[model samples]
Target: MGPLNVSLCMIVRDEEAFLERCLASAAGIVSEIIIVDTGSVDGSREIAKRFGAEVLEFPWSGDFAAARNAGLQRASGQWILVMDADERLLAVNEAAWASLLRQDTAGYYVKLISYVGDRTGGDYVTDYACRLFRNDARIRFEGMIHEEVVTSIRRLPEPEGIIRPSPITIAHDGYLEPVLARKNKKRRNMDIIREALRRTPDDPVLHYALGSEFFQNGHYAAAAAAFQATLPHISPREGYASDLMLKTAYALRETGERAQARRLVEKAVAHYPDFTDLLELQAILLMDDEQYASSLLPLASALRIGADVQRQYLYNSASGSGTYQTRYLTGLAYERMYRWEDAHEQYEAAIADRADYMPVWHRWPVIALLLGRTADMQRLMYAQAARLPRSAWSLTANVWMNGQQTDALREMAERCEALRAEATVLRAVALAQDGADGQAIDLLLPAASRGNSGDALLYVWALYMKTGASREAAACLKREAGGNPALRAMAGLISGEGAEVREEAYRLCQQTLMQLAAWDCLDALHAQLPAQLPYPWLPLHAMYGYLHAPFASKRELLAQCTRRFAALGYAEQLAAGLLALECGGFAEAAAWFAAAGRQAPDRTAPRIGTVHAHAAMAQEAARGYGLPALSSDYRFLSICDR
Candidate 1:
């Protein structure tokens, strides 16, 4: 029943905002508190003193270890627990702590969940650190930045000292965006890291640390270079090596070095075959290349590894390495292969595992519709409505899916009534989608009267265009354009008052047109356009309109669009080919499909389309009394189909 005699030590500078919360959380757990303030102008010192902490003022020597060691030296407890002023101890198992203290372990690894951004939905990155350790003279902190006491502990007589896992969880939010914007922490860390690297030029740990810092800052090229430099010195047995490899692969991918990234991931997977993160990355790379069938093996491997396995290093929560994520990725792979039944099963399993994962909810409906599973769709809608009862978006989507537009509009109005302008516009969009453009316009006009312009006015313009009220549509568009210069240029182009406006607003226009289902308006806009649209998909929208309004040179137009998209990439080419098939331009579709198949042989869409195209050609040839080259195409397609 005696005190465990745990001392909570912290080094802080201008951390008044978070210091009180941090100290209060550990007040009951820690027997003693040591606060080392390194030149804090704020009331951090007073805050620490208020908590009865032994406050020591240390000079700012740009060394985190020196400040940390000052606190450690003042601590009078049997055990030391190092914590930052911005971090709070969430939970601790006193029984486990007492048990661990009685053991011969030199240190304990505590779970540290650091919030990287807004923490509204538990958005955090988890890692384990040896923050709790025995209070021995040999166990002192090190490094100018990212200071650690592990190295000092490792130098003990038992170099491989037993480091046990303790039931302590710390939540840190200093890395979140709001905090980062207030304090230039990244730049400060970079400065210290550079200084340390300069002192110990060949330190692999410093290099890896620098690489991680750069990766977090979105400097992918610099991060990849630093990671590559560390690779030669990093030992495979070291815990940080796997993390280094994984981060390097991600950096390489971000830098557009996909081939190199794939090779590095594959190499890492070969060495650490059971690493679910590596396997998941491999599957993602394969999927990005459109090799859906090939991605299955890695996805299966990751799923088999499961979430129960203990991780040696830090892992991303968003990565598809966990049970729900692995199942979701497996579902995506199955869907790409056109195995709807298998895909549906995997998706259902994923939903069952983590019902609150919203991405699964969005994709599940599409799959259900594709498979014509109306009953399944209804079931999913009901389940989602139940799970996310407070989510207005989910409620709206559920009502819309159930074919209750009136109910959906009423729900939207009730749920979002506080934001009257936004709700009115949203309700109007729902009305427009339900073929009530006049009512949608009537709903939007009041907001327009109240001088609501930007998005609201744009919606009104679209409604007028949908109702064939050209004069009214133009007036609304011009009014909307008055504020957004980009819209002004686009409006001028559409109204034939100016030259073509090739800015990014074209995509927005295309999206708006698609939402309105204004196929004729899209065609009119496309005809007046001076050059090709920015995105390949934009043309497809206009082409879709031509599905009903067929033209003599439709195939030629489709072929031109397909060629343009083919030049962009395999994904775009596949999309273009599918659009062609949908528009009945079989020849153009066949050419693009063959091209895509050549680029990515494992893609099912291209292969299936090729089969359909070849079959159609063969039937036409037979009808014209001429033999077709069906055997070659059919054989290749059949192999891919299987």
Candidate 2:
């Protein structure tokens, strides 16, 4: 009935941005607030004062435990709650709070829900942190970085009953990309962790911390090495054992060692069958190698564990692996296996679980498209659009634009007034492709002159080139590029003196190339493309394969193009193989066709192309051996012709 009298304690430095949010979340619950400011130049101290916190200035000794100990010493309550400036305290277990404080327990493990990546959305990893503890003199914090009170608690007598798990959850954003950059936390933690490792050379905790720092910063190779080093000493009894194994597998995954990663995850899963993160990771590794059937096993097991594991914090598993996200992954597996209806059902379940999930949003409609349910797909698209704010029309349009779903895009343009510009660009592209070059230019010039042109300008320049005004087209493109890297790359690409561009700009280049190819502009593109490509060069190969060829000799030229597409990926294999078939290289064409057949067995084109390629190979053999060509052998001519 009375106040729980929980003391909220934290140590902060230049955390003015998140300090207020942290304090506000706990203001109604905590009896007193104690924030030890470690030489903050910001309003962290002032913000603490606003929440009626006891602000203590502590000199930065480069030891988090020391600073934390100072705050623990100042706390005057039955229980202490530790939190970071970037963390917001969630619900407290009031039912157990009084009993746990009165009973024989050193502390409680609070669930820490940390949002990963740049966006602070649904995707998060959960861990149990020792943030709740008794305000005891003997239970001060330990370790230099990632200081823990549990270590000190374990040092006391009868440690079996010392620690307990609670329903308290803390939502952490310190791991989010932008926040980590603003705080310069990755470097700080790595420096401190390395220094600690120097003192205690073979420390499992320090190595784990080092791996985490590297993993969060996208240095997966270094993270894998750090995580591997910890494996020799860590036991399953360790709090971070499952998490350590999970992270190690992910590090390998990131570094393109999927086979090794899958093996490690399988072994780890065997060791920790109940670990949801391991199960989810196992599914991912299986899916990566195109083993869709095997992937479903782990995914099903993960879902079987379900909300039971999600509700608990045994390991730092992504929050949705046991729920909607797992379903989404299952949907992917089914989709890859071409089980359209099954995939559709899983995607539906995922949407039912979390309607706003963008990953599902993109794939859900595609399933309907796959089933030839265009009307159903349109309905699904409308349902998703209805959820989004009207101001996000561009975002909605972009999803369709990226997919090149012209019909869906046109439908959206008809429904939303904000999409008129995008609709104009699409219309201009279509007009230019249909040989309406002058009309296309007229439609785009007004948008360009008014400085509102984005993709439209690219169409304008291409249309100008179509009119045989190369000089003016170059000038128009230069004006359009001005300072934009994407436009600059487009110009560079067209002039046959290409330069490297950033990834974002390169994607725009890819998108623009698709439009340019539609307008029958491959001769310029093929001549202008750089010798080396930055992947996703599908448009180049796709455009070239459609050439109205004489099927004449150009063996070396076509071979070089095939090799380039091969380097990019198997996405353009059929197109590349068809081009090879057009040239005078029967054996080479057959090889390309065979590779493409293996890549897409379900597709009729690759299979038919393979038959034609073999027929050509037979004809070439006939020429070499002085025999009748296969096409003249009436028995197989029909199969080869059609």
TM-score of each: 0.80, 0.75
Q: Where is model 1 more than 4 Å wrong at Cα?
A: 1-4, 118-122, 158-160, 252-267, 288-291, 309-320, 324-332, 335-423, 451-454, 531-606, 615-642
CA-only RMSD, every prediction: 5.9, 7.7
Clashes of each: 0, 0
Model 2 lDDT per residue over 400-443, tens place: 44334556655775665546657677666555545576877888
Highest TM-score: give the candidate number: 1
Task: Flag clash pairs in model 1.
Answer: none
- The local lDDT score (0 to 100) that residue 384 gets in candidate 1 is 59
lDDT of 1 by residue, 1-642 (tens): 444689999888899999999998888877889988888999998999998898888998888898888888889999999899889988667787678878778999887877765552344666778999988877898888878877777778865466777777888888788888788988888899899988998988888889999999899999999999999787777767788899999999999999999999988887788777778788989988989899999888777777556644443334345577888888888866667668878877886766665566656644554444646655554555454423434533432423324444455556543334457766776776677888888887887877763366777787777678889889987877787778888889888887556556666675566455565676566566654544444343222223332343344445455445534555556555655665656787798788878888865668777787767767776785756544322212211222
C-alpha local distance difference test of each model:
0.71, 0.71
- Model 1's alpha-carbon lDDT is 0.71
Candidate 2 lDDT score relative to the true structure:
0.71
